[model samples]
Target: MPTEPEPQRPPVGPAPARHELDAERLRAALVRGADPDAFYRRLDVVTETASTNADLLAAARDPGTDRRVLLAEFQHGGRGRHSRGWAGVPRAQVIVSVLLRMPGIDLADLGWLPLLAGTATVDAIRSVTGVDAELKWPNDVLVGGRKVAGILAEVAGTHPEPVVVVGIGLNVSLTEDELPVPTATSLALAGATDLDRTALAEALLRELARRWQQWYVAGWDVTGPAAAYRERCGTLGRRVRAVLPGDTELHGVAADIDEQGRIVITPDDGGEPIAVSAGDITHLRPVP
Candidate 1:
C-alpha cells in the first residue's frame, strides 16, 4: 500500500505591526525647532500613573518646579470632570498633562483654559488624522457627534502663583470593542489613516503652545479664542438637554456661547435663555 501524502500548510501572511510611542522620540519631536524654555521646561513619560493631573498637582506644591509635562501610557486611576474615571488601553491613546504657573493671570479668565485645550485638540486631530473633530461644549472633543477625547483643567496651587494642570485623553487606535462607551469613538474607528502617536502628540503640543501664547499675551481675552471655538463647536445651534448639577434637566436649543465660555440655551417653551456654566449636554434630534 502506498503511503498517505503529507497535508499541505496554509500560506502565512505578514505579522501585524505594533506601534509604540517612545519618550525620547516624543521629547525630541516636541523640542525640535522650538523654544524649549518658552514652552516645555521638562517632559516626562511614565509607563503608568494613577492620574497625571494628580501627579502634576502634587509637583505644583513645590514653587520651584517649572512648567512640566507628563505623559502616561496607561492610567489606572485617571479621572475627568466631576471625578469621572477615565482610562484607555495601553499604548492606544494620548494621555498627557501640562502644568503651567500663571503668575498674574486673573482667575476669571482661567475658565477658557479647557476651551483652549479643546480647540487645540480639535486642530491637532484634524491636521494629523484628517478627522473633522469638533468641540462639544466645555471640553469634550467629538467626531461626528461621538466623543473621541476629553479635557480636564484643575487648579493645582494658588499661593506663590496659580498653577493649572490641564490633562487631555484622546483615543487613537481603539477598536469598536475597546471603546469606553457606546457614544465614544476613536481615531481608528473614525477613519483615520495615520495613527502615528509621536506626530500626533507633537502636533497637539505645538497647537496648544501657540494658542496658549496668544491667550496669555492677550491677557486671557476670549475674543479670539471664543470665536475660533464657536466655529468648531458642534453643540451650538442644536437642540440639547443639559443635565445640571442638582439632577435637574434643561431642554432648549443651543443658541450661542457667552464670553465667559458658558453655553447659552434658548428654552423651547419661550423662556429666557439660560447660560449654563457646567453641565452634561445631550444633543436631541428634532422630530420630523
Candidate 2:
C-alpha cells in the first residue's frame, strides 16, 4: 500500500489584518451549540480596539452597560498576567476579555479564575490546532516549550457586586520576527499550521464558558478541574525563581499548587517552605 502524503502548510508569516467580517458570517460562525441570544448579547467585536479587558472593565463599571463580552481583532495596549505589555498580530491573534458578575464572593477566592481560563483555552487550542499545549505555573500556555497563549484575570469593585474580567491573548499565526520574545511561539510556529483566529477565539470562549459554569456550580474543590489543572501545570516539581514585590526573591523547586491554588515552593537552600500568593515564576528549565 502507498503512504498518503502530508498536507503542505503555508509558510510562517503574519496573517493579514482584516478590518471586519461580514455580520452574517460572524453570526453563523459564533452560533455553534450556543444559546441563540447568548452569542448576540455578549458579542462585542471591534477591528482595532485597544484592549478588550480595558473595554470590559469600563463597561462593567457603568451602571447602564450590561455585563458582556469583548473581542478585538488587535489590541494596541494589551496586557498580560503581571501588567506586561503584549503585541497582537492583528487578525492572527485573539484578544478576548470576558466580564462576569460575582456577587457576595470574597475578592481573594477569585485568584483561581485565571487558571481556569488558561485550562479552558488549552482545551480549545488542542481541539482546533491538534496540539497538546501545557500551562505554565499560574496561567501561560506553551506549545513545544514555547509560550503560545496567556490569561490575565482582574477584579474590579469591592464586595456586594464585584466584576471579574478575564483577558486571553493567543498567538494563532505570527511570524518569528513579529513574536515579541524568542521563547514565545504561535499555533503555526509549532507545527500546528491549521490556525484560524476567529475559530480559535470562539472555541476558547465556548470552552471557557463551560469551565466557568462548572466552577461556579462546584464552588472551589481540590478535585475536579483544579486537580486537572495540576496535571498539565508545567511548573510542578521544577526548579524555579520567583520575584515578589519590593524586590524580594525566592529560589526553589515548585512543589505543587495547594488546594487553594497557591503555589507551594520548597526553597533550594533547604530552609523553609513558602507559598507565593502572587508573583512572577521563572521555571529554570524549558517546558519538558
Leading candidate by lDDT: 1
Flag clash pairs in model 2: none
**TM-score winner among the candidates?**
1
Q: Which stretches of model 2 miss by more than 4 angstroms? A: 1-40, 63-67, 220-223, 285-288
Instruction: Write one digit per residue (lDDT tens) for candidate 1, span 179-269.
Output: 7887888887777879887788878988998998888788777898999899999999888889999999888889999999999999878
Candidate 1 global lDDT? 0.84
Cα displacement (angstroms), candidate 2, residue 169, comes to 0.5
At residue 38, candidate 1 shows an lDDT of: 48
Each model's Cα RMSD: 10.2, 6.6
Q: What's the TM-score of each model vs. the native?
A: 0.90, 0.85
Candidate 1, which segments miss by more than 4 Å at Cα? 1-18, 32-38
Local error of candidate 1 at residue 23 (angstroms): 2.1
lDDT of 2 by residue, 1-288 (tens): 111232343466655444342334444555433456443244667878778888888787775444466777778988876678876767777778888776555566777788888888898898988998989878989886678888888876654566788888888767777888867877877777566666777688778777766766776443566787888897898788888888788888899898678899998779888988788877775233
* Clash number by candidate, in order: 0, 0
